[model samples]
Target: MSQSTLVSTRIDKWLWAARFFKTRSLATNAVELGRVLQNEQRVKPAHAVKVGDILEIHHADQVWQVEALRILEVRGSASIAQTMYAETADSITKRQQRAEYRRLHTEPAAQLQQRPTKRQRRQLDNIAID
Candidate 1:
């Protein structure tokens, strides 16, 4: 087998090398925070990841479900990072649908470009009182 095929790395390190997190510390923190799961269960930073392992990662407001395709010990460019995993089709569909849903249903607070003025606040209070 090729060296690439034989290689493996820690889950947290892989996360950093895969560009999932900007730093190893961030990756470790996320793993510790339960934001990263392997096979749907929480994993420690030192847990080694092998190819074909399903990873459920929560980064920012988006969730990713990807299957490990390759493993690496060093962080690389974005293009290289993408080659490490294959995001499932179902995951892609779900994420797209989620984005569309969020777009269609924006938060009320987000709609306001700025905080309400004193007059506007009073009006809002009166409307709430009614």
Candidate 2:
């Protein structure tokens, strides 16, 4: 297939090419799970993705709303992948805010490096019982 001349490609392929997912199968799975939406609507993996189409992708607790700029079937370098889509300004701001919030306030459970000791477990049980 002519990679540069193409006007459209599968949504899964586009996601992979844009580096949104590590592999095409993961992109397909995202689409199937409704984590990937085209123009704010859930789409199939095989849905045609054209230049200028808006896409919302959710993964790893992060969301991105981008406009497709290029249609590429083959995965390439990160720089090349980044050029395939342009993130919306609102999406950029929201992601940055989320990252800042995470940096400022870590999850309470994240401090636990290992499973609780017997004493801790007993205490937890006692607390639950009460």
Candidate 3:
């Protein structure tokens, strides 16, 4: 990379490089859907990115903050990608806790809400008639 280049890269490629998404296209779709922000401002997939920019990426029910350290135009393996940006520890903790909470709470209520199958429904109908 040239001194001035600082490896100027696209937002999608940066997201993938930062290990935010599994693929470049997924990152681009997230940007296009306004789920990615830079400095609190929404950005497009092709947005030019440089070092020190903070990205807020919304994934599922959680958000991730990544501070860019190096920019690259192409995606790399997870280990190499991890070197491109730094993830905030707080965000990871919050996401893990939220996931654990949801996992514990979702099952009981979901079981209650499950509709009866046709056989069960027929049994209920016969019981009511009898």
Candidate 4:
């Protein structure tokens, strides 16, 4: 069914359909964990989400503030999912800035190619002892 025809859908279903979470259960879990807000208020997974309602979704290290443009119940193509919500300008800017910062600053653990060599381990132990 074309999602645009629906007046409203469950928040979890909408989140999954919009591709915010990988599955409906994940979306529900996120809602229960207080990672999602509807109109600035915490809502249950079954909460009804209508077109034009604002949503704040926090996933991983990024936060999204978007307005629902269509009510969807089924997951769809990425192109179709992108059509369902319109992110606010501030949200877009914040996400971009965060992405840039992450790009510029690498994760410390990411530098490790493998387990430490014996010499490296000994050096680490020596440093710890001192």
Order of models, best TM-score first: 2, 1, 4, 3
Clash pairs of candidate 1? none
- Clash pairs detected, candidate 4: none
Candidate number with the higher TM-score (3 or 4): 4
lDDT of each: 0.92, 0.93, 0.82, 0.93
Question: What's the distance in Å from true for residue 114, model 4?
Answer: 4.0
Off by over 4 Å in 2: 118-130
1-130 per-residue lDDT for model 3 (tens digits)? 6533666788998887777888888999999999999988998888988888888889887788878888776666778777888888987888799889988778533564578889977877898899
Over 6-117, each residue of candidate 2 has an lDDT whose tens digit, in order, gives 9899999999988999989999999999999999999899999999999999999899999999999999999999999999999999999999999999975687789988
lDDT for 55 in candidate 2 is 96
lDDT of 2 at 80: 98
lDDT of 1 by residue, 1-130 (tens): 5547666679999999999999999999999999999999998999989999999999998999999998888888999999999999999999999999999999867767899989988988998899
- Candidate 4 lDDT over 5-99, as tens digits, reads 79999999999999999988999999999999999999999999998999999999999999999887888899999999999999999999999
Please list the residue runs of candidate 4 whose C-alpha ends up more than 4 Å from where it truly belongs after superposition: 1-4, 118-130
User: Which residue pairs show collisions in model 3?
Assistant: none
